[model samples]
Target: MAKTILVVDDSASLRQVVGIALRGAGYDVIEACDGQDALNKLTGQKVHLMISDVNMPNMDGISFVKAVKQRPAYRFTPIVMLTTESQESKKAEGQAAGAKAWVVKPFRPEQMLGVVQKLVLP
Candidate 1:
């Protein structure tokens, strides 16, 4: 089966960009505007991986990661946080919240695909 990825971001442009890249790499993509919506989507959908932004309206990436890890179904799901800068404190918080890795924006499709490939296939 094609791997499913849930992408959560407040920016429509960023979401579209990431969605297109994941789709081009042969993965199923699901979009959510914020962490709250992402959690709602997870109720009925199965996802192999998740890509989320650090800053959002409803809930931020760190909080989202914490929520995701709380669910047994999502405990092992790979998540990567997309951010504009590499903040050490934020990265640590994300890691503690159960994110497998972090990707600083502006995201490169090829580079992100490579990270996704390794995480999903490894």
Candidate 2:
């Protein structure tokens, strides 16, 4: 079965690009516009991974990651922060919030896919 990945980003173009890459790699992709929207989509489904943007309306990626970790069902799901922020502090914050990896914006699809492949739950 194909692994499912939830992608949360406020930018429509980013979501589309990530979705295309994941779909091309034979993984199922679910998109959300923001942290709140992503939470709404969780629905107890089995998701192997999540990719999220840090800056957004409603809730930010860090808060979302913390929230996801609090949920028993998704606590073990690997989360990757895909964002423009490159500062070590931001990356540390994301890690503290339970994100397993960080991928900076303007990323090559192949590069992000490689990280996804490595951290995705089996």
Best by TM-score: 2
Candidate 2, position 32, lDDT: 97
- Cα-based lDDT at residue 113, candidate 1: 92
| Deviating ranges (above 4 Å) for candidate 1 | none
For residues 1-122, what per-residue lDDT tens digits would candidate 2 score against the true structure?
99999999999999999999999999999999999999999999999999999999999999999999999999999999999999999999999989999999899999999999999999
lDDT of 1 by residue, 1-122 (tens): 79899999999999999999999889999999999999999984678889999899989989999999999988889999988849899899899899998999976899999989888732
- What's each prediction's TM-score? 0.95, 0.99
Instruction: State, as a TM-score between 0 and 1, how close model 2 is to the true structure.
Output: 0.99
Error of 1 at 14 (Å): 0.5
Q: What does the lDDT read for residue 16 in candidate 1?
A: 94
Candidate 2 ranges beyond 4 A from true positions: none
- The true-structure Cα RMSD of candidate 1 reads 1.3
The whole-model lDDT of each prediction reads 0.90, 0.97
